[model samples]
Target: MARVVTKPDTLNQLNQDFEQQVLTVPVFLNSVPKCGTHLIRNIFRMFVPVNQQYHDTFIQIPVLRQHVGAFNYLQPKLSWGHLLFSDESAMALRKAQHLVVVRDPYDWVLARARFFLSDNFQGNLEHLKSGQINLEEILNMMIFGIHEKVPSLSDIYTHNAAAWLGTGTKLVRFEELKHHVQNLESDDAEQYFRELLSVLQLREFPTDWRERVRVGSDREQSGTYRDNLTNTAFTLPDQLPEQQRKLVDYAAPGLRNLLGYCD
Candidate 1:
């Protein structure tokens, strides 16, 4: 489908793209879904109060173009929509420290696919289990970008690396830090927060935010998609048909191995 070319998406996307030219003034968080970004964003929001001093934009709707505009002066934290590598989004990503969040694609896919059953998704979030759609349609859409890349984060890893591959910025995996900041069994979570805070350069974290670091999440699990996934919840990678598997392999090779699925 051709893009809508509407004013806002185009304008915001364009603004976001332009803002990438600035330096370490803005730290871009290119997040793939289910990638532990919520926890990190919450920590940043809670630590850096949005009073007159700082502005924290985490998952702002419509587009993050407005927040990206603040790239001129150094801000303690900045978070937003995925930083795709289109000619439009190239600017802000170029000067960013390039901290991206990734998840095992298989698990991530399964977790989202289950959204069909949720009341919140309504009919638009179609699924065979929801009784509002056919399995073939969903499968076909997944195999092909049949409708659009609504759910795909779009070459985010490549986008982050394109501007600063050799630079000193780091990429964090969702799975690695899942328990790092939330498992309350030991002293590890505190140490993890200190390390994470140091990385974002936040001096003091809100007391509640610090308490939540090793506790629960800001929202319920996006894992609701699990109910409708056909095979094993964790290993849907193997259940995908051959063509689908090959297609996924072509689009994201690293993801196949990361999710531990056998084609």
Candidate 2:
């Protein structure tokens, strides 16, 4: 099993600082593995009471059956995970308000490569961290994946994001989420969040929505945040290289378009 080393966040304690509402319906924040899972989860944490938030596990396919109660409509909780599209998952989320978060494939490749190379991630690919493989090779591995080891980008996106579309799951783009968080003072940001949080079915949007978002969106609280990653030997490019970007398109084909990242 792969392990991610993330520092404990104060959001649970900070959540007390706000007047939270009990969730009337279960809410699931599903996403492609590297597509700002914590960012969306953290923001929602501020609006929900601590006890109503599922802290049992990250809720993946393997242990989903055990945590099926996270989606219990009668005991509604705010849960998040990398659940793929399947009969089991579809049934599990049948009674919940589902939100799927995704990032542009071009950028997802970079994020995956960076996380795998960082000391914070300990998994089978730890061998790649020895600098034996060049950055390009690592990036390629992220796209096509290591044979029989990591799953390819297309496989991950197809099941995790694409297939879930048109299934009534609301799509939330990482870029748009981050943009609104960064510009909370603007009317556009206000409207953006109102729409985003609409799935939660809060009786009324809180007056201090901006402050809650600011606290929840803090990069320092995110262990997987790019700058927060530790002992990263290589300096990753701010944008994907043209060659690698083309490789993403080739590997995933219509992925970016399916996720509304491209025309």
Top candidate by lDDT: 2
Using TM-score, give the best candidate's number: 2
**For candidate 2, lDDT tens digit of each residue in 110-194?**
9998898899999888888888889998889999988989999999999999999998999999999999898899999999999
Residue 56 shift from truth in candidate 1, angstroms: 8.6
> TM-score of every model?
0.59, 0.98
* Candidate 1 whole-model C-alpha lDDT, 0 to 1: 0.45
In model 2, the runs with Cα more than 4 Å from the true position are: none
Error of 2 at 25 (Å): 0.3
Model 2's lDDT to the true fold? 0.93
List lDDT for all candidates, in order.
0.45, 0.93
CA displacement after TM-score superposition, residue 254 of candidate 2 (Å): 1.2
Candidate 2, residue 79: the lDDT equals: 95
TM-score of 2: 0.98
